[model samples]
Target chain A: MNPPTPRPQPIGRLAEATGLKVPTIRYYEQIGLLPSPPRSQGNRRLYPDSAIARLRFIRHARELGFEIESIRQLLDMADHPDQSCADADSIARRHLADIQSKIARLTALGEEVSQMIAGCRQSSVRQCRVIQVLADHGQCLGEHLAGSVKINEK
Target chain B: MNPPTPRPQPIGRLAEATGLKVPTIRYYEQIGLLPSPPRSQGNRRLYPDSAIARLRFIRHARELGFEIESIRQLLDMADHPDQSCADADSIARRHLADIQSKIARLTALGEEVSQMIAGCRQSSVRQCRVIQVLADHGQCLGEHLAGSVKINEK
Candidate 1:
């Protein structure tokens, strides 16, 4: 007897099963992270059961702070299970290093800001320590910490 | 006699003096962080000398990781130098707290990633520790950390 075909799930069910939003699922398909699934007779997207494992992998990597590009490479490695894990190991290492660098930078910033606040006497703006330091970063202990704050938002 | 009219600086000179790119300067204006400058007879922007100090303040605040909304409020406080510094102090305190929180999060992420890499044996993908942890987050000690890695980029 032939093996029974796996049941196909609708897009909403896929989103629910994966803890991913409907839009996020569509976005993943658009980005080619999730391959286009076969559509239903009514043109609804129907995902095979395997998509759960794949989406979970993507979500898990994202939580671990992996960049999309790195995740893409890792996914590719996952697809070809026989490939050496050196590339995956390297990608994780690089991400760890990047995280460490950011921690160091942010720690310095936190120190400077703390110092600025510590010096404040709750006085008028004319003599506010916080304003003074922000207005002239020269007063900051780590003037070298100057850079775009955009890192935390991206 | 009235004070001599402040020298007007062209867009290029303003950019040079402030270390702000011309597009950034224009963007600041467009976003209302900067007031629109009067045009010269040739319809070129003519920024007053005061723009230098203003832009410097914005740059300093940005470097310190103040969000645009907070910077707007701080700028208002700076404008009214006679106002009590309670708002500025609170903003600085809040920012300091935020930086510390991010440090905590990133520090945890760094440790987890480091551990994942450490456990990796540089073996075949089938036995890769990193892949195992990523594919099955159940293997991770902190399974709750599954969230966006976009914090570091921001």
Candidate 2:
């Protein structure tokens, strides 16, 4: 177990402790996802040890495919640990729905793209099935979105 | 179809033609993804008829989930229509593989989130299954990643 190295650490140390880049930590603060930590006498940002858990919570939420705005709401909900989690549940449900829809669209695209590649026999562009399929969406066999697939992967 | 208007239209018309935003057309030009079009005597951008095909191709490639860099390669290949499509095929195959991996990850996350939602009975945050599932990775039931799910929606 790491000895409690004298409470607060610099922003860089905080980043290192959380496996997050320095810029990302600052960006989180800038976006109000993370509260601004106190500053040292030399104008250096000093974050308390508690920041680690907060940052980790945000990071973990992001890894679970929650969008930034959804994470903000989740963070807010988590702040009031004793309140009802109905909002949290709703947010999770919405995120889950979005992920499912994206998966469905991607799965269909995967099949169509796979078929396009398989159909192509390393021929010239003139005879390239992949090119033809992309050039004309009507050639696709799947119902996957050829004109629109609303997804924001971040 | 209506008769073609006098040779060149403004950037707005170009955006309308391709269903791209005005700024996005500018961004494409800035990124060298789309070639700069000729300007009129008043310094307004004037795209020739060929620009429509070029922009549509870029948009279609994007809808197919090809990354910007892959789209660049595809565009370059399209420039030389007489060339073999081996590169295009490889790019499409690579993109297809990426999309497949992403779908797999999202599917796992979707299930976990759904379970968290299903297990919840609209309880308080203290006893909230969804919050517990997110806050503590060990609560996950499936082999899905609780600490990591690499995907972005946009």
Tell me the DockQ of each model, to 2 decimals: 0.61, 0.51
lDDT of 2 by residue, A17-46 (tens): 776789989999999999999998899998
True contacts kept of 1: 0.76
Query: Model 1: which residue pairs collide?
Result: A150-B154, A151-B153, A151-B154, A152-B154, A153-B154, A154-B153, A154-B154
lDDT of 2 at A71: 84
CA displacement after TM-score superposition, residue B114 of candidate 1 (Å) = 1.0
Best candidate per TM-score, number?
1
Q: Candidate 2, clashing residue pairs?
A: A151-B153, A152-B153, A152-B154, A153-B152, A153-B153, A153-B154, A154-B152, A154-B153
- Please tell me how candidate 1 rates in CAPRI terms: medium
- In the range B39-71, model 1's lDDT, one tens digit per residue, is 988999999988888888888777777898998
**lDDT string, candidate 2, B18-114, tens digits:** 7788998899899998889888888889988878778877776777788889889888887777899999999998999899888878777788788
User: What stretches of model 2 exceed 4 Å from their correct place?
Assistant: A1-18, A35-49, A142-154, B1-13, B142-154
